[model samples]
Target chain A: MGIYRSNRWLVRHVDVKVLRGQLVYIIGANGAGKTTTAKALLGLIPTDEGEIRRGPALKVGYVPQRLHINPTLPLTMRRLLRLTERYKNTEIDHAITAVGLQRLGNPFVSTLSGGEFQRLLLAQAMLSRPDLLLLDEPAQGVDAAGADKLHNIIDRIRIELGCGVLCISHDLQLAMDTGDDFLVLIPHEHDEMDST
Target chain B: MTLFDDFLIRSLIAGIGVALIAGPMGCFVVWRRLAYFGETIAHSALLGITVAVVFSFNFMLGVLISSIAVVVVMYYIDRSENLPTETLLGLLAHGGLAIGLVVLSFFPNMRMDLEALLFGDILAVSKTDLVVIWIGGGVVFASLLFLWRQLLTSTVSEDLAKVAGMRPDLTNLCFGLLMAIVIAGAVKIVGILLIVALLIIPAATARKFAISPEIMAALAGLIGVVGVIGGLGSSLYWDTPAGPSMVVTLMILFALSRVLKISYGTTEKSATRNK
Candidate 1:
């Protein structure tokens, strides 16, 4: 399936399948439709061509490149994790611990360092026990060591939950061993179509 | 009239009731940075006033209908076109106000106080106005409390809210309906021109001191109540326009909060982030 924004297609003739416990890495450059593809796959945005299907009652957890917590709204990390759904005290603590953010002390989400922010998002994603997990550049703004830890955590989540994982990133070196399959997006594919 | 005893007391009660509901709704307006959107809602309210005048009915019901119509038209425009929202809001705001004024001009013999209709004649509030404010304001207040979680979630992230099956669009539609209801009740308190200021200033001021959403909402209400009381008292003593006086009082409060924020040196951590 493919999606279009404006008059031209963003991504066309794209096909990928992810089974339970499988990791699919969608690698692409800027404007390569990685984010758009992920959004379309989740039904967040509509696609212009082809059909997309998902298992019924599929629970989804998404870690976007950015989680816009408007500065106007004061939100503690604990509150951010609990914003979408209510969780038990122990369950919240467990998710924070799983993401190695156990030292969180009710700091506003805006105060988090970049890596801390990404990890915090990961913690929230895991809270729902999702059946399909999508991460959009999950290792963004993270140091190499932190990136390694993030990969390991994702791999563990995949094994533990047996959820299909879709990782959208530009970095080829990101968790090389974890990805069961890879899809690369080319920039200016629209240009190729325009020329023809 | 005898139950309320004094006109001053009646206006005070009326103003406070509007403040009570405005505080929480104002926070959502601020958090979502819908100050202009609120302005549009208020401006469209002027058109609602015109409809009421033409129909010879209760102004509150008339305002409610017109505002709902404007909101539906806005939703249609937003979905049907890619026009920048602000541009459309500007068009609707001025268009509604101008059309209402022109319509009012056509009926010069209607025996209406146009100034009272524009800037608000809060001190002239009748018994029915108070009843409308309390009963309607109470319902909006309760509904806001019930839908707090869904509202906050949608404000934070529409996608996340959608994932949670919260239906962000429906949540927003509910919010607009509530805002419209409040605007209907507010027309007599602050009128159309100054109603948004009453909604926004208190909430913005309260944000300086609040550490959580619930606190912010509560503090905003308190600020609004204080503004209304102070504004009305000053208006009585100094003979200023009641609605504008209240708005000016709110501004002073907001300025004081800025000073308080600076003196406390709360650091730049919580500085307002542009959306």
Candidate 2:
């Protein structure tokens, strides 16, 4: 059962499930629990009284809305990639090149522009050859060309690895264009429910 | 000057070692706007120091225990969904400070001087203290180096870090450990209040000039070294407290950097208008 539930805070009585190998998109306004829900699923935040069960020891890859890599952090892509999974130097190079960041793996993360940094995050996510991929606003800072490339990479990875994916986005058109199953978070007013 | 030489050199070495660890760690504190968090953790050291003194334990031992306890507590509070961070830190900081004062008051028979621990006395550091500082500092340095990638990922973006298989909870525990060790190491040199300043101001100074994280860590270390040297020299010559002078040097650097940043900003604006 691909299911999780939480009502710990702003999200009240939330529960959902999807079959394995589904490409699901989660959409909601800012205050809705899209990010919070995602975090809960990832086990970043505890589910209060609920239980989150993983499917068959699946390796989950996530990309968050904002990664505030403090300028003081001593991080290089080569180092960042190593943290994610075991890969040969050539594989690391290939991944970097795949993300359009070839030969820049040694540079510190803080030096990259916004788009470059996001791509690096993407590459790190793919390092594990994960079974489930979760991305939050993968195109926020990406240029049009970069966004296209990111989408293509996501498609390629999914096809090659045969993994499930859950993507959250504020862009409805982009969500529509992706042509995946969608999960919408609509806040239900209790008073309206009482009237019903 | 033999006694002076022995104490000064030893203290300087210890101070630089502490600064090196604290500077980069403090950069994360400043960047995350966790100045209050640092102070809260530091204040908890007093209670730790008091417990150590009352029980006839070594002062460093007491500090280490109390510091670790405080960090563990803070970590728990930080992750608790029920309360906000500012509220949690505020309650713990003031409560710990008050408890420490009370504990020390209860130990009137204890002849140990509390002033040094509260305000720091680098000149009073012993050979044993120096050895502990080295071991502890080395551990912190090596740990940071080992976890450099994970730390950077978590600090910049916890979500991405987790996705990349870096556990933010563990990373935060490591962060707290570094803070606790630093408090224990520097409690004899910079005191509690000024210790946080050492961690923060140097990194802030480095930030003004550096554009990348790797360079920023290096620059922060350099700034810390320079600050400690100047502060130590001035305090020794002028018969002032080492902590205050060190803090002042850092403040002056911060002011200078701000001025330079403003000048550059105006120049850029003018250039853009002319173009």
Candidate 3:
């Protein structure tokens, strides 16, 4: 897939595939189109070139890097979970417990700490039972210990759901350790088509 | 004597009908920060009036069409251009108002009172005006209720709404149309200049005490109703203009609400902090 702006390529010649039950990480430097590639794969943005064919009956769940909900928006965690799909109380409880956020008593989303918010987002993604989970900077704003715990949770979730996991992150050392396969995006000055 | 025969009675009914609709819609306006958008549509009602008079068309219909036109133009400009929404709205608001005034100046033979068009003359509301206000307000209210969930979700986060399969753009377009309907229906009762004040003040006042979106909307409607009653009563006693008096009444209520909230010592900021 390729993305261009004003006849200049922002991202080009990207070919990556995620398989079931596998963990793949897309690693890149800043402004190297890591998030752009993930968005394109999720069909959030159109690709200017090449074709992206998805498996039949594919269900993809996406957890964005950071969700900046308006402070005035009166959304509780329970209400937010209901926004994407209608889940029963038991299912919601299970998902919240799965994310290790069982202590929160339907707190307002604006009141959540950054790590807690990320866990809530992950719980939201888990609700769909998706065939593939796309996470962008999933450990962002998390402490080192919390990041490790989140990665462990991601591993367990992948194993339990048997779903493919594609994550975008700048933490190369962590990505190298966690990913089964890695796609590294290198920025080039010119708009040349190349892939590794 | 028939109730409709009394001009004051007619004005009260019309004003209350408008408040019922504006209150809830105003909540969305406040949440989305669309005050300027409302002002733009309200200001353009003058252009609609001028066009109706010049072409011998129905004034309300003219207003609806012109307001929708502004919505359409603003939508396209927002999508295609890089201009800030505030700049675009400022240009359109003053431009439409100025053009309407200039056009009206050309027709010295027109019988309509420009002052009434600008500041409103609610005491002169006819039975037909009541019908339009109530019916239009009903439709707007029903539409808002129907789209309430999706609208609230979209207001919270457009990206999340999209992921949830709700189309934010479509919701926004519908909202713009609803605003047009309200502005057109209200132009005769509150005038173009003061319509936004009615839409914004009560909702802002409600925000101080509301714990949820539904409560905020309900409180806004209640406050608006009280403002209408108080303003109309004071206007009858003092022999003052109805529209501006209503706005002043709303402002006073808003001030009172703030004072009461502060004194009661349960401010939202403190409550959130405690949480």
Candidate 4:
């Protein structure tokens, strides 16, 4: 399946099957349909003409480009940890401390700094312990220090949760270091489609 | 208290319930910049009222049904359309209002109390309405609580929310349902035209002082209560329509927030000078 451009496809025909329990990183240049590919997989944006299939009772835990947590919203990091209502007591504390946000658990997510928010999102994603985790540009807004911290958390989560993860990021070196597999989108294809 | 006094107390209690739900939900509306989206649901209440009259059903049922349908329609359209949300809202809002008016005209025997539907009839509210509002409002509030994290995730970043294995589409549908139920219940007290003002104005005003969603929701609820009560009380004292009075009170509070913001800015400057 592919994402449409004016004439050519943004994402070319890619046939990659992820085995259960594998960590995958989708690496590509800017304007690549990396985000589109993730949306297709989640069934948010429709596939042009392909039957996308997934296991039964497939639940997705997604963090959008922005979490849109209003400053007025009474969201504490601790309260957010129990979103799925299935996590054990210690698990909540573990997830918070894992992201180095144990201290900020009671503070509202909206009050978090850029790095803090990213870590908070990571912590919440890990809380559910899902079968598959999808992340889009997880380090976009994070600083150098925070990005390094995020990479470590990513590695630990894969080992700790034993769940398959597909992350879309422009950080190619980081993806290579942590990602077990890769998918790249071709940006030139969209530009070429407009000319044609 | 007399029978009238009891109705007044119950109405106030129901208002408290509405404030609680609307406060949190409106926080999303203002932050996500979905003020018109809230208005769309409010406008559609007219159609719901018209349908209720046509079918002889409880008016609230008609409002609930129409509100739900409008929200579902909005969810899909928003997902598919590349157009700005405001553009889509303008189309649906005018269309919904026109259709409601036309539909109301068809029932010649019906004394379409346009004013009541436009503003609302707080005095006419019944005991059953309170029960419906509380039960339905309670469920909506709990569901929102359950989805709080995922909702924030999706609200902040849809891609991230999906990666986390929480579907934004499903979360949005749930949010839409919440908005629908809110519009339905609030239309009885605030009316179709002014309902959105109650939902959004208080939340927007609350945002000026709030630092997080949790505090924002609570403050919005407080603002809503203040707006409703102040408006209701003034209407009783001055012999004005309750609906407009409540909306006016909200507007005054909103204005006061702006003034406070200006004063605070000046205070900061003066403190800097002194320092």
The digit string of per-residue lDDT tens for model 4 on B56-87 reads: 88888889998898888888898789998888
TM-score on 0 to 1 scale for chain A of candidate 4: 0.83
Task: Write down the DockQ of candidate 2.
Answer: 0.23
User: Ignoring the other chain, what TM-score does chain B have in each prediction?
Assistant: 0.94, 0.90, 0.94, 0.90
lDDT value, residue B227 of candidate 3: 80
Which CAPRI quality tier does the interface of model 1 achieve?
acceptable
- Model 4 residue A6 lDDT score: 62
Candidate that scores best on DockQ: 1
Report the C-alpha lDDT of model 3 over B46-153, residue by residue, as the tens digit. 898899989988688889988999999898899887889999998988899899989988988888887788887888888988898899998998999889888987
lDDT, candidate 3, residue B102? 95
Residue pairs with clashing backbones, model 1: none
Indicate the worst ten consecutive residues by lDDT in candidate 3 chain B: B266-275
Provide the TM-score of chain A alone for each candidate, in the order shown: 0.91, 0.82, 0.95, 0.83
Off by over 4 Å in 2: A1-24, A27-33, A40-57, A71-120, A139-164, A170-196, B1-5, B107-115, B209-215, B255-275
Q: Is candidate 2 or 3 superior in TM-score?
A: 3
How would you encode candidate 1's per-residue C-alpha lDDT over A1-196 as one tens digit per residue?
A: 8776787778977798888889999998889889899989878888888888888888999888777777768777788888888898888888888888887566777788888888888888889999989999998778889888888888887887789999998887653655789888886544564433
Q: List model 2 lDDT by residue over A1-196, tens digit each.
A: 0122443245545565544566778778876778887888887766654566688877888877787765544456666666645579877877787677875536656667788888887777777877888888888877888788877777776776687878877766766877467777755445234222
RMSD (Cα, Å) of model 1: 3.3
Ranking by TM-score: 1, 3, 2, 4
Interface RMSD computed for candidate 3 is what?
4.6
What DockQ score does model 4 reach against the true complex?
Answer: 0.20
User: Least accurate stretch of 10 residues (summed lDDT) in model 4 chain B?
Assistant: B266-275
TM per candidate comes to 0.92, 0.77, 0.91, 0.74
